[model samples]
Structures are given as C-alpha cells and as structure tokens.
Target: MEKSPTTHVEYDSSNAHSNGGDAITRVPTQGKDAVVGTVRLLLGNETVLLPTPSPDPKDPLNLPAWRKWSILILISVFGCSCVILASGLGPIFSVIRADYPGQELKANDLMVYPTLFMGIGNVLAMPITAVIGRRPIILLSMVTLVVSSIWCQHSGSLGSHIAGRNVMALAAGQSEALLPMMIQEIFFLHERGRKLAWFVFLENFLVGIFFFTSNYMVSAWGWRGWYAFFAAFNGLILLFSIFLLLETLFIRPDDASTGQVHLTLNDVGKVDEEGANELVFRVTTKDKDFLEPEKYGVRTWRTDLRLWRKIDNWAQVSYFYLDFLKGIVHPIFFWLLLLNGAYLGLYIYQASTFATILMSPPFSFKFNSLGYVQGAQILCCLVFLPLLGYAGDHLIRFLSKRNGGVYKPEYRLPSLALPAIAGVIGAFMYGQTAAHPEKYHWLGVALNYNIIFFAFLGANQVALTYAVDSFPLKAGPLLVVVCAGRGFISFGIGYAVLPSIQAIGYDGSMNVVGTICAVLAVAAIPMYYFGPTFRKLGQNYYGFGASKEHANGGSGH
Candidate 1:
C-alpha cells in the first residue's frame, strides 16, 4: 500500500449546512441516466460497493459479520417485542368489551386508534433521532413501552385504558422507522434485502404466533396477563440494548465526501504490487489518508455502550421535519406511501375483523380455536421468509450485471409485482368467502387470509428497501413519510372497515378494496418502466443528486 503525507486539519463541529440533503446529493453522477449515481464495476464488471466504507474499524459498515448480525438480531427482537405489545389487545377484545359494559368504545377504537398513533409516534421519533442518535431513541421508547403496558393493565376507566394503549402505540412506533434505518446503516446495499427480510419476518411471524398464543394467556391469567407478559419482554430488551446495542452513526472527517466513496476499476489497478484489496480504495484526500483505523482509536465495550453520539452539525436538525414533508411529496416516496398504506390498511382490517367474522357466522367458529386461522399465515411466512429475504437482492444483482454493472433502484421495483398480484387475488377470495360462510368452508377464509399476509410481508420488505436504496442518506426522513403515512392511512381504513362491511357487505367492501389494490398494481407497470425518469425529474426538486457545494459548510457527512 502507498502512504500519503499527513497534515493537520481544523475541525468545525458547528452546523454549516441548512439541510443535510447533500449527504446523498453529493455522490458523483454520470448524467441524467445516473440519478442514483453509477457504479464503476470491477475487472469482471462485478457490482461495486455503494456508500463505500471507510477504513476505520469503528465504522459500522466495517464491523465484523458476527457483530453486525448480533446487532441486527437484537434490533429485530426489540421490534418483535413492540409488535407483541401493540397487538395483544386484539385476541382479548371480547373480554375487554364485556368488562366495559355499555361504553361507546368499540373494536376499532381499541385497535385502530393505537395503530394510528404508531404512525404518529414514527413521525415524532425521526426529528429526535436526527438530533441525538438512534440508540438513545431506542432506549427512551423502550422505557415508554414498559410504563405504558403497566398503565394499560391497571387502568380504572375505559378512556384511560385506551389512552394507555395509544401511548404504548406511540412508543412502539419507533420500531417502524428506526429499525429499518438502523439496518440500512449497518448493512451494505447487497445485503439490505435479506437483513430487512429477517427483521420483517420476525415481526410478522411473531404477530401470527402471538395471536395464536395470546388467547391461551388471556384464558389462564386474564387480559391483564397479556400486558404483563410484554412488559417483562420489553424490560428484558431494554437491558440487552443498554449493553449490546452500539451506535451505528459513523461520521467521516470533514475532508472526506459526505456521499458514498467508491473506487473505479482503474483506481484499483493503481494500488501497490501486493494486490491487497483492503488498502486499494484508500486514496481519499490530499492531506489525510483513508483506512487509518488507529487514528479513530480502538472502540472498547465501554465506548460501544455510549448512548449519545456527538452531532457535528446540529443545524441539520432543523431540516429533519422539512425533509420529511419534502419526502412526502417526492414522487417515489408518495407512491410508496400509498402502496404501503393500502397493503397495511388491508392487513389491519382483516386481522381486526377475522375473529368477529369467524365466531359469528353460520360456520360458527369456536372462540378458543379462532387462532387456527392465523396458522396459515405463519406457514406462509415460513415459506416466504427465505424467498422474500434473498429474492430482491438476488434479482437486482442479476439485473445490475446485465446493465453492465450499473445498478438502478428500479431493479428493486420489479419485486413489488408479487404483492400487488397477491393483493388483488387474496382480497377477492377473502371477501367472497367471508361474505358467504355457508357456501364456502371457513378454511377458504383462512387460506385467503394467508394470501393477504403474504402480500403484506412482500410489500413491506420491497417498498421500504426500495425507498432506502433510492435515497440512502435520507432514509430516516423518508421512512418517517413511509411509516407515518401507512399508519395514518391504515388508521382511517381500520376506523372505516367495519362500517363499510356493515353497510356494503363483505363482498362489496372487498370488491372496493380489490379495485384499489388493482389500481396500485397497475401503477407498478409504469413505475417499473419510468421510475428512473421520475427519479431524475424529482432529484433536484427533492434535494438529491446535487453537487458537494450544496453541502455548504458541511453537515459532518
């Protein structure tokens, strides 16, 4: 490896940039064709690493494989715990309504309201996380989750219990935005799909498993015991996070590009004759050398345990909310907002009503055995886990190879096809079967319900992953748009679904839902074909693909 002469550089930790959009905008581009920036392939035209890693061992991107997976598992478990806490009320809904007597509280208010706040909570979390760090936000939310669970358990009034659940939903909302953002921070582009699938799989799988088991818990110890179970689970997660969860935000020195660093095929050939791949990409700046892990110092376990990280540019905090609004309007973001919301709303509506429909029909399902319906979803997830996990990354890699090693975010869009198709078919089957329980066996409802969940799992992984891939640095704000949009939209759907079912009947309501899914499905055709052009048009409008000069005084990259 070659060495560059070292020179002292003044550090300015103060905020200089008005918005941190340049973090992604500063990546060098080839042209309009390169809105996502082009990757200079290896000698064999292999896919180049995106958001290139620094030499610092302390960089999350450079962490060992075991360490990265460990953190991912911990975060996934935390997210799963939140899911369990948020949805436990559903299985025990009958018991709660019986206790409340003649109160105006209904199933939607109990379930939909908290679900809505989860979106509200997601929006609230981003600004704070943007300012402080992800670790602190996780710990803070976990504390809220624990307290709210206890409050929900011991509530003296119907209103108070509902309020407690809303608070718990708010706390649980952090998992929606932060978990995906953290996964993006830790994993490379090639690995994101699979890792994200791992997180979603755990969440969806646990939701299914919890529904299956929650009734038994309620039967043995009452609905309050459900709350107690999650409170303890959350408490344990809080402990694990305090010691094992490290901060993933890695800030480069002021001289380096805030955008991802990459080396071309030519640049690789310029390295020393030893052919050391580790030292090949280190030719960064005039004064400072890249790959200097020693300068950053060794990160001891104590350092990893730190909750708050220094933000070199606090001015970036001011832009977090504004970027969220901007992201809401960005073409791709808006599309995903709708796509995610429609699927999530459909799923929530089904889960909320699945029990009521089954237990009250001519088919007459036993309350104790209602969980058997969710077993189909669990099996679907188990089958789809490996498929959804690896398929997106694999498909894009193949597409990238065929594109002469230039990867486009559009490659990720194609995978949305599965969910879109599933939505249309599943809604039709579920709606028709649910409406006529006498003609169709209850198994029809269960099997189609499984199909809807399959769509939910696929849509979630693809939509979230594509958005992050499109706007890598701006993931936090973009996810706020995605998570909050889905939450609010789904909340509205949850609030209205039962009324719609009552007014129009299950078949008619599902026909409307199936039509909406069809429209979204059709929209994907254009999105896959013209997504890059749309992205190019919106890049400047959204503060993406801009030059480094746009970074102004630098937002610490």
Candidate 2:
C-alpha cells in the first residue's frame, strides 16, 4: 500500500542548489487541485501574495475604511471600558477595605482572583465566540459586565465582592481576545500594526483615566459610588454596541468555481486568456456549502434587538476547542505566549508594587494624590503610541519595498528593540528611586513609570501584529493562547509581588523582575532571524497556510 501524500509543500534546506533552489515543492493530493500557490524569493526574503478580499461588498475586508474604523473604534471603547473596570480597582483597594470593616478582603482575594478568572474565562469564552458570532458574544459580555458591576457595588461581604469581581473579569476577557481577532478580520496586512496600537492605547489609557478618577469618585460618594459609576458606564456602552456594532463574521469560500480564486507570486509568470499575467490561481471547493453574504449591511434596530438569536455556526464547538489547544502547542504560538506572559507579569508587578511604595512613609500620598502618578504614564502613552504605531507600520512597508514588495512577519521584530531598552532603563531608575525615596525626587519616579509604560505599549503592539501576520488564518485560536496565558501568568506574579517586595527591598525585587523582562524582550532577536523557518515548519506540520475558507472567499472568522 502507498502512503498518502502530504497537504503542504515542503522546503528542505539541505536540498538547495545554485540554480534557483527548490524553496517550495508541491506533492499531489487526491480530490484537490494541483495548482498550489508559489512561495517566491524577493530581495533574499520569502514572499507570497496574501489572500485577496472577496467581491461581496458585505465581506468585512471589503467594507469601506470609514465604516471599518467606526466599528473598530466602538469595539475599542467597549473593550477599554471593560479593562478599566478590572485594573482601576487596584487604586481603590483601601476604600474597599474601609467599607467592609473587620472583613478579610485582601487584594489577592478581590483583585487577583478576578484577574485570574479573566484569563480562565477566555478558555471558555473564546471557543464560544469562535462558534457563535463576535457581535453576540460582545454584547452578552457587556451585559454581564454591567450586572456584575451592580452586584459588586451592593456586596456586603468579602465572598460576595469576590464573586462579583470574578464575574466581571469573566466578562472582560471576551473583549481582550475578541478585539484583536476583529482587527484581523477587518484590516489588511499593512494596516493591522497601527490599529492594534490604537486598541492597546485605548485600554491602557482608559485604565489610567479611570484609576485617576476613582480616587475622586470614592471620596465624593464612597467606594460603592465607584462601582455604581462603572455600572452606569458599562450599561451605556452595552446600549451603544447593540445599536452600532454589526456582525463581522462571514463565511468565505475557497474555490474559483464560485467566483473566488486563490493566488500566488509564481502565477505572475503565467498569462490569462486575454494575455495579461495570470497572477491568481483557482482552487477547488473544500466546502461548497459555505457562501459569502450578499451585502455587508448595517444591523438594524430589529436585528440588534434580538438578543437571544442563535448563531448559525455553533456546531463547530469541538473543532474550535481543538484548534485552540493545537495553537497553544505550536512553536511560534508558544514563544509568543511566553513573551506576552513575561511582559504582562512584569507590568502587573510594577502596578502592584507602585501602590505599596507610594502609600508608605517617605511620600505618604493622600487618596486624591494616588492617581496623579498614572497621569504621567497616560501622557507618555499619548505621545509615544502614535509614533510607535506609525513607525511599526512604516518599518514593515519599507522593508517589504526594500525586499522587492515582499513582506515577512519578522519585519515587525525590530520594534521590539525600543521596548527592551526602555524596560531596562525604566526598571533601573524605578528601582533606584524606590530604594532611596528620600534621595531621588518623586517626579523622577514618575518619569521612570512613564518610560516603562511606553515600552510595554510598544512591545504589546508589535507582538500582536507579528502574531497575526505570521498566522492570519489561525488568529482566533492563537489569541486564546496569548490572552489566557498572559492573564494567568500575570495573576500569579501579581499575587506574589507584594510578598516578594516585603521579603526583598524595592531594589532587589525590581532587579529580579527587570532582569527577567529584559531577557524575554531580547529573545525577539533570535525570533527575527529564525521566525520564517518556524512559519514554514508550522505550514508543513500544522497547515498554517491560508485556510480554504479564507482563500476561497469564505470568512476566516
């Protein structure tokens, strides 16, 4: 009996020769077309034409730029609001403690548990979002957030507060993963980096804004007033989302028979019947039943009002779960997961330790003054985010043009350098200042905090963009690993940070964490050099190629 042919085209490095090496070799597979896309060399870098947008005007990719931005901005706001509720609690832990006198409500119990659950919830939420639709899950998550906020505001005991916070965290996790996946769905390859930066900016900046204001809100009406404000704010966002957000999920087709075709750079050499270069190739249908919607129509009041409508693709639950697990184990995904986890853990440690340092002897900041420090970090983000976003997108464009219009995911890795250097400098300054608070002015500490925030934002935007560029088809599942891994790891580190700081003074703790962050940031160096090889390996081993749905004009959702 003969062995079955592999689905992927293998590129064996050992078999290269002087004459244009066999970078891609196709093997015949039964029931599928033999015309696999070609991977060409452009300026010594591997390149291929990405999947073209479907002709259907209703396809998310084919939507007008203005319309896409509108939707993205709304989603960003909703997501940012959810994140603010989660992180803003850190600044108000004292108020909460005072509210429930004699109750054992540690930050770990109230804040860390919710943080951990936010990640844990994604394991359940993402697979559902993958099956159901993005719009439904988002709206539902917002409703849950609203209710949880209300419950938290009325909590009379430690257990009730923990439960409410856990629910709220679960709701927030939906946005954390879904926003990036939505960006991948709506934006083109060249556009994702900057858009991701916008998403990160909104989340981090809003967290600062909310934290800054919570001080006043608590002072004016007490801690419950803070939860009430969140409840009202979340409720408004939920209403706005229902009316404004439309379902971005579409079923794209794979074959040319239904007016869709997949293409490769190799086809640039072939001619069509009209004598033009046949740059696009046609593939057979992998799933003929999947069809693109006719129009990219905006959701009406009636459509949006149907809160309980069943999503059509819910039967793919098993596949969604399996895909998420498989992505977690893939080398590229694993590397990104670890990198994200380390960076987030370090940031969380900084936030947790910041409160301890400022609330202590040298600079006994009043309740109102507690949030002013974050203002500097927010300002820092405001200045650097746009520049970094522009630089990241421009870097890829410049490198692609330099390499003869061929773009590789590794091009994004250089942006990592800014964050790596900034993190080291910021950590040293922050640690030294914190070690001798009386010697170094508080403003210097604030400047170091801003530096760290700037680096964190830059690193996050680059990593997310790189992940999507590397595996556009598998983005949904890949994000599950990124979001969940970061959430859990950060929670663990956050829980321990206070204790660690107590054990070893500020300088010792900062040195340990800063060293870890610097090391992880530097790993991007090796990734930039070897990333393409890993992508090729994933293609062969995990079918990292564009899915039939994505290639054939079906939704990659």
Tens digit of lDDT per residue, candidate 1, span 263-371?
2232444443445321223122121223344555776887788889875356665677767787788878888888888888887777777777788857777766876
CA deviation > 4 Å runs, candidate 1: 1-33, 37-46, 104-107, 252-291, 311-314, 546-557
Evaluate model 1: give its lDDT.
Answer: 0.70
Highest lDDT scorer: 1
lDDT of candidate 2 over 64-96, digit per residue (tens): 677788778788788777777776566777777
Error of 1 at 23 (Å): 24
TM-score of each: 0.87, 0.82
